[model samples]
Target: MATEHPAKARAPHRRPFQVATGVLGDLMFTTGVLLALLVAYSLWWTDVTVARHTGVAAEHLRQRWSAAAPAAPPTGTADTAVPPRFEADDGIGFLHVPAMGVGYQVLIKIGTGEDTLAEGVAGAYTNPYSSAMPWEPQGNFALAAHRDGHGAKFHDLDVLKPGDPLVVETRDRWYVYRVDATLPKTSKHDTGVIAPVPTGSPYTVPGRYITLTTCTPVYTSLYRMAVWGSLVREQPVDPDRTPPPELRKEDPSNG
Candidate 1:
């Protein structure tokens, strides 16, 4: 009879509270896991898409450079006519480099007025605020590009040495330049390293001068690496004349 008291039936209904708490905890943990997965997937997809688009843009530029050929001669006799300024749509007609396998379409945008530089493509390293443009006769024709490891637009710039040939083909003519010197960027000097032609210097020069600038140490932007080349030769585009074996077809075959 004493045992019949049965310890007051021990509150049999309390089981529901424990079950509810376990269910809520599990739901919360699952939601957190799903949210984390979504975040990771979003970031990875973004990076992959950007890289793919960059490669496509780079290849398109290279192909345009390859397909361009010099302008044909006049139907009749020799007529002297100054060509128009370079433009992006005109295509890159010529490219030259003997030391390393390098070539690309030379695009010229208006340095004055609006932002003419191509989007997604590397820009000329020179200051955009300056009065001079890349193709201007006396202005700084500076160029900018991503290092080889990332975008690698001008990866071979470091390989250029003195005497290396640099030829740029426009619709009507081939502008040739010779590598003269390489300068390491410095903070103290006003050498106008990125200027198309050295300004404020005693040397008075004519024609076009090209300055190739890129991230220093091959793949880093810690310092600017520049290669200066002067106009060495100028050849008129003659459709009747065949280009040199090296120049006729794209060298390196791969841009």
Candidate 2:
């Protein structure tokens, strides 16, 4: 009676195409996870590391300034107004934008190259005499920084409006600038934005101007954003290391 019992059912074999598709899906998922981790490191971890390094650097710079002798006042002439020419490695100065945020300051170094800006600091353009020091009487104090990552020193640049203070703190003086114009976007190759008399803005005459440049649209570097300002005044850094009146004002544009 059991002779006619059904044979054991066999398991269905998976097709080769199905096996290949499953493996491909798994590979794609792993790749996606790796990419996400990379992005997170770039956007988050870089900022953290740079901030820590830059803070220590900034403190060292201030200590150096304190140890140095006081600088003589500008003699009014352009030639005399030019302070001692300093190399980039000497820690040029500090940039403070009250409108950006409380305690919003970054070290000023001498090159706009990636290596310099990646240290979470602003870099002065050095295209063979394209930039000027804050102590220089009349030239573009052009600077560049990252807008989204690596401390994003100029990320809040778009919030600045006409009349906001852009202060540059040096060992002996505070070079104050007032925001006058902004170009929301421009070609990254446009050298004129950092020129002695920067083009593509309200500036047409040569003067003591400041240019703050950063990549536009936040996370991408497809283009550039420029902020133009005129040197409003200079205040001597007193013995007490007091900040200027502009920095003392409330941050009105930090919304």
Number of the predicted model whose TM-score against the real structure is largest: 2
Which ranges of candidate 2 are over 4 A from the true structure? 1-14, 73-82, 251-255
Candidate 1 lDDT for residue 114: 19
Tens-place lDDT per residue, model 2, 97-174, is: 988988789999988888889999999989844687776657899999998789988889899988899999988788
Instruction: Report clashes for each candidate as comma-separated counts.
Output: 6, 0
lDDT of 1 by residue, 82-154 (tens): 4445443222232445555534533333231113222223453324323233234554444554444322545
Residue 95 of candidate 2: its Cα lDDT?
93
Candidate 1: minimum summed lDDT over ten consecutive residues — where? 111-120
lDDT values, one for every candidate: 0.52, 0.85
Q: List the residue pairs that clash in candidate 2.
A: none
Question: Top model by lDDT, which number?
Answer: 2
